[model samples]
Target: MVVIAVFKSSRPEGKSAMKWFGAAQQRGTVMALTALQVVICTVWLTTASPTPYKNSQYITSKIVYECAIGSVAGFSMLLGYIGLLAAVSFLLAFLARNLPDNFNEAKF
Candidate 1:
């Protein structure tokens, strides 16, 4: 969703703006990037720790040590990516504020 929003916000006005990258290309790019994001998260979470157990005690490892550290790191990285995308989107939108709205409803 953020990827799509960034692309839409950065799109310039005029017929020649995105002559080579039409709607199809935009959709493809978004889909590809979304898939890549999913893969990255999946890989990070799945392979985060060498083993789920911290010590020989199964109860302690499973109950108290349930991937606390790895999950935090993974989520922090995810949050960083989201924050970066948001910053880019905000910058693009601010720069394009003077341009005509792409959606007619936006003028209302």
Candidate 2:
């Protein structure tokens, strides 16, 4: 997402802006980077020593006995966070492209 934000800032000279970020190799590169990030996070999570909090018998409220709820909630939160980042970055790119660079300059 940060890569897309930085890539969108420059104006294209001879080619379309899509070509700048959407190259055939770029898709693979982005996927690889994302996977690498996830793997690193997973490694950290797996290697970390758990604290003495025995409360983890219930990741969520003790009222819910189904463990699936906790996993589902976590998955949803992750997806929502990723979606929000993409949406906000795209919105910023849109505003950057359309808004006037300088408001002080007079047309009249």
Candidate 3:
């Protein structure tokens, strides 16, 4: 609506201004995904540390199993998050392909 309102007078400058603003604003496909993934994974990692079920007080087979299983579960969860993040990043980058060519373009 604001785009149309800005160009209500039908000036090419308004059109150009809108174009430049939109292009600049829409160019963050990878950055946004990466930032989101990092933040989520950081939170996940912080919350998941210490392995809730791990115990080294006893060296029995049951204790060993518990530690191994807990470690594996934590690692698996991290891997799942990584895979999901990768897929999301790929999809977002694909969607943003037509946003703007000025992304990472030469500054000089």
Model 2 per-residue lDDT tens digits across residues 21-90: 5566678877875885586445544555223333445555554333232344445545665787689768
lDDT (Cα, 0-100) at 87 in candidate 2? 92
lDDT of 1 by residue, 50-90 (tens): 34544546564454544445666777777787787789778
**lDDT tens per residue, model 3, 59-81:** 65555434333345656666787
lDDT of 3: 0.56
* lDDT score, candidate 3, position 25: 53
Better of 1 and 3 by lDDT: 1
* Cα deviation of 89, candidate 2, in Å: 2.6
Candidate 3, residue 52: CA error in Å?
21
Residue pairs in clash, model 3: none
lDDT of 3 at 13: 48
Whole-model lDDT values for every prediction: 0.63, 0.54, 0.56
Q: In candidate 3, where is summed lDDT lowest over 10 consecutive residues?
A: 1-10
Candidate 1, residue 106: Cα displacement in angstroms equals: 3.8
> What is candidate 3's CA lDDT for residue 93?
62
lDDT, residue 48, candidate 3: 60
Q: Per-candidate TM vs. native?
A: 0.55, 0.33, 0.32
Which one is best on TM-score?
A: 1
